[model samples]
Target: MKVKTGTLNRVRIIGGDWRSRTLNFPNQAGLRPTPDRVRETLFNWLGQTLYGKTCLDLFAGSGALGFEALSRGAKQLVMVEQNRPVLDALKKNSEMLKAQNVEMNHADGVQFISRETRQYDVIFLDPPFRQEYLPKLLPLLPERLTPEGVVYVESEGAIDPGEGWEVWRCSRAGQVHFHLLKRTHA
Candidate 1:
């Protein structure tokens, strides 16, 4: 059951079970899927397979990171998107892919994360760059991540991982500055 909201653009999954498969997302402001090269590098840094890992995509704009994680062997995935139309398209794509062990939430990412009790092995954080989302959201992530968990961030400029965290790996793709961050031991 495809969501018939409007004309949609497609982004191809870079690797894993759904590699080469495409998912549809609506044309909206500040909704950019992580580029293929960026994803490839990210997965390389995170390792090829994500078996048994539970993942969260807080700003699941196009379900790109969420779906990619699922395809790469994540055990469970939770995607939270505030936009109804975008969430609808994500549902349509998830159905099309027949993805399993996935949960969808139609709410603000920060709000969802604020009340979320479960810890995750990985969390994808790619919010709109125009707003100061990273600063607000970063402080909330440490508590949500398991001891070994990591956060993948995509932003317009370099991010300060705050006092107790560190950027484990980072790379640039055009204007996008992506990083993998983990909590540092004291």
Candidate 2:
């Protein structure tokens, strides 16, 4: 419940016993966990039929997205985070929630994508701003996503999806924008 290092930013676990309960995260190290309003909007976009779906959370800072997916009834979740301290914090959070279906991986996001052979129903990507990892990340997703699956990318502004995807939705919330893409055929 207490995330060390900075001020505690309270978050609620969506659609679970702890739903609406306040959970805290350390705000240091530029760790701005996604805003709750955005998270609620994202899940609403996903709908209530998310139960039993497989989810991949890349750039899993604070593990909020993946945890929310699971809390909303996602059957399985794989969170890939490269930073060591963040990964440790994520593991602790997962344990605190007693989420047995979650798998935590510490590795560069790109490497994790390349090595993962399984497909997921939903993939959440929130790479660091201006990193332009989208171009490099998009090509590798076809093999990792189920047919008709969606990839959600959150960035500073609009993402053009220049390669390997057909944009399904592009919307903005304040300073952040999100692109939801479906894989293109080979």
Number of the top lDDT candidate: 1
User: What is the TM-score (0 to 1) of candidate 1?
Assistant: 0.96
lDDT of 1 by residue, 26-115 (tens): 987768898889989999999989999999999999888889999999999999999998999999999999999999999998889989
For every model in order, what is the number of clashing pairs?
0, 0
Q: What is the lDDT of residue 156 in candidate 2?
A: 89
Q: How far off is residue 81 in model 1, in Å?
A: 0.3
Q: How many clashing residue pairs are found in candidate 1?
A: 0
Clashing pairs in 1: none
Evaluated against the true structure, the overall lDDT of model 1 is 0.92
Candidate 2 positional error at 112, Å? 0.8
